[model samples]
Target: MTVTRPPDVSVVVAVHDTMPYLTACLRSLVDQTIGAGRFEVIAVDDGSTDGGGAELDRFAAEHPGLFTVVHQPHSGGPAVPSNRGLDLATGRYVFFLGADDLLAPHALERLVDAADHYGSDVVLGKMVGINGRYVRQDVYARTDPDLDLYGSALPYAMSNTKLFRRRLLDRYRLRFPVDMPVGSDQPFTIEACVRAERISVLADAVYYYAVRRHDRGNITYRSSPAQRLDTARRLIEFTAGLLPAGARRDAVLARHFDWELSKLVGKDFARFDPETRSAVCAAVKSLSAAYLTGRILDRLSPAQRYRLALAARGRIDLLIQPALHSGSAPLVLEKERVLVHLPGFDEMEREHFVFNGAFDSRMASGIRVLEAAWSSDRLVLWIRAPVLGDGAAEPAPLGISGVPAEVTTELAVDGSGTTLCARIPMRALLGGRRHDIRLAVTAAGELYEFPLPALGRRLRQRRWHRGRPYRISVIPGRDEQMVVRVSRVPWRRALLWRKQ
Candidate 1:
């Protein structure tokens, strides 16, 4: 009798009617630098009517030992197919790959190596959106060999596309929830991250998540508002059930609140009909009443918190007014409350419509950087913001953080509301890494953060100190924000620049 050794990694692909894309996906698997002997491909063909099943069979026949093709009746959701593949995974590590997505040639090799090197039960290699698809980049800002799920931005990046240890899954019986037709990946990924002894994040781009230009039939695209709302509610309940009530739990729940809950009341929400709108508001109220802790609510932005608060209080009409008003609603300051003038809502209950909370009377809707320039090797930003307090205002302080450090400056008044002149020493950004700049102001005991628009010039500068060259550039970032990148100029590049 001959014994076959278990593969080091198993790539579980749940296939639907993804044909041409599936071919590319399988090819990527075949070309993996991890070698076919080290990793096996389990392609679960869930009744792929578009000849995808036949393609999978052909690939299995050609690849033989490297591929395993399983056919099952059409499952309405990917969860069933995913669970089927997980049940048959026989490897030290298991990675879930989307049927329509492509992996880099060295993806599995790097993921497996990182997992082994760090003893990580879950290893997330950086993934990017391809073909106009949007993937959140917050968690991929940098690599952390051992990431803290609750302390970091991992909560927002919970997708089941990464590598998971087989033993850990077996130990906890972790599997996708079959009932969740959409968004089931989040629950499975979140639970695995919670139970894993160590979770790692690699900065290398290893996966390409594509949004087929011709086919937007994926569950996420096909899912209705009601379906999304239900899934969000279930996710909130599930996350709340997993961790105890505390800051850690709040951190995880905050993602759901911001992405899921707040999304329910976003711009397109106003387009929903009366019945659908009512249903969404009711669901929001239920979830908020059940799991929205004060800490979690505080974690939300002022706009998000206000929209959700209106929804929770069954003021759908009031919630819809913001969209109708185009945010041109009048702001009335009564004592310490700055309220957006909306009809049918009591001004006294300022908690529901106010920008922040009680005793808060300001908004950053008008805040912007009037000028950004280098003043003697120091980056200076002149910002105009809303004026709140009187001459005795003290105006609070303004700050921006990126490399574990914050540069703060006092807000000054100059005939135009309030202004801030922040002088950031170039030396503070000397490290050879990208720094994500975030700006926030503390006024009236409430903190309001705003995005700095692209300064348009691609502000680039370089300085030579002690014979070593350093370069710094501030440019537009995702979502109209700005980022600062600093690096040490290589000798070759410096010489090239000198010649230029």
Candidate 2:
């Protein structure tokens, strides 16, 4: 099995003890729609004791020139094997795939096409999580044929599951940091992005990132908090060193703070020992002090802003306060405003304490529900929130966050009032998971957000779709307001719809 000519794409798969999923993963690669001759698989078996090495050999032998196997002693991580694969790659472009993951049928073809068309040094294929959770593909919300890593939201797609031109790698001398036990890919991906002149995005291409059920062997699930924090600090330092101070640098730092460091102050923060908690808080505070600025903080969500501020100030007690009062405060919607009454935080006395704005403007500007109905047959829910005042400006063009404006609803004015309504098909809104839907309105050229008030507890309904029961209840928010909670039927019947 020898290569006479360069291939279109070189897929580098680093495998350890993933025997159960290796077969499917290998099969997916060999049967790629991009054609066997166009691509090659360089499977690195990292001293797998689970017969994954034998599986790799068998695939390589069967595929002949299409598959190559590199057997090496276990390095305790994917970085070493990945670098080895890079050394052996001969294709014009390179792709790194996890041995447990699978690629969509046309993933390679789509990526290659985008790269060729834009002469891109890197092309990011969309990633889909299987039996695992993933961040929303907001980075791919809109397509940009020619994407700038620093300017665009491309930094958020920092995973190594992308197509890279071999030329770019050689030019920048990019390699994964073998010293890192976790998140080694972060530095490599960040460097590649920063150095590459042209990076294209192929939103339609899919890379299935599979999560093993009941298996804690995955490196991500096995890393200790200290190890992760160390990796995060290294990554932040590496990324910060690449870019100068400005909006671009701030954007990247914002993602790290909001997504990675912010986890230290999450609900699970209480589970950590005092020492570990203090170490995490210290690391977060130090990083934030160096990189986080008002511009970056201003763009984050209110919850994120609150937690980050507390962490930066070393207010561990205040940081954990929200978790202690979790679901304790009932949301109150009165006087055309939504309020969450934290035990210590005074809502009435403190100005700008509550999340209120044009939605509760004194000039008779508020939404009122005129009618509500759900059709199980069509899987659509209809709600009419009409403008109350006589001179109201067409209900301020209502929209729902987490939902596309075009598909969420429509606006119409009838004799009753200025109606803001939508025939929201559940299929469109329910993305196979529970989502918090916030109402957004553009009033006087400014956007205002309000929680979609729950119709009423008694008005709640249970509907079935495709043999599964979905409980649509009007739950009170932690703040004073109503939110529609659409959830699957609880496994424990007694705990179904219990008040939070």
List the global CA lDDT of all models: 0.79, 0.70
Top TM-score hit:
1
Off by over 4 Å in 2: 1-3, 205-216, 322-325, 330-500
Q: Candidate 1 on 1-500: residue-level lDDT in tens? A: 99989999999999998878889888888888888899999989998899999999999999989999999998888999999989999999999998988889989999999999999999988888777677888888898999999999999888899999999999999999998888999999999999999999998674545555357766677788888888899899999999999898899999999998788888868778888899988998888888888898778876777778777778777767654347544343334545444444343255545544432223445566778888886888777655433322344355665533334434443423446667777777775467666567554445656666667678888888678887889888887677888778898888877777
What's the CA error at residue 409 for candidate 2, in Å?
38
lDDT per residue (tens digit) for residues 1-500 in model 2: 99477899999999999978889899889878898889999999999999999999898888899989999999988999999999999999999998888888788888888899888988887776777645458677666778877677776778898899999999989999999979988889888888888887766545455555457566777788778778778877887898898988887877787767777667767777888888888887888878878888776765565565556667677656753336333223334444333333431232212434333452123344445666662323344443322122223345667544333443344422234555555664444444455656544445656555545443456666666667665456655455556678865662454543
Clashing pairs in 1: none
Tell me, what's the RMSD of every candidate? 15.0, 16.0
Clashing pairs in 2: 331-479, 331-480, 331-481, 332-480, 332-481, 339-480, 340-479
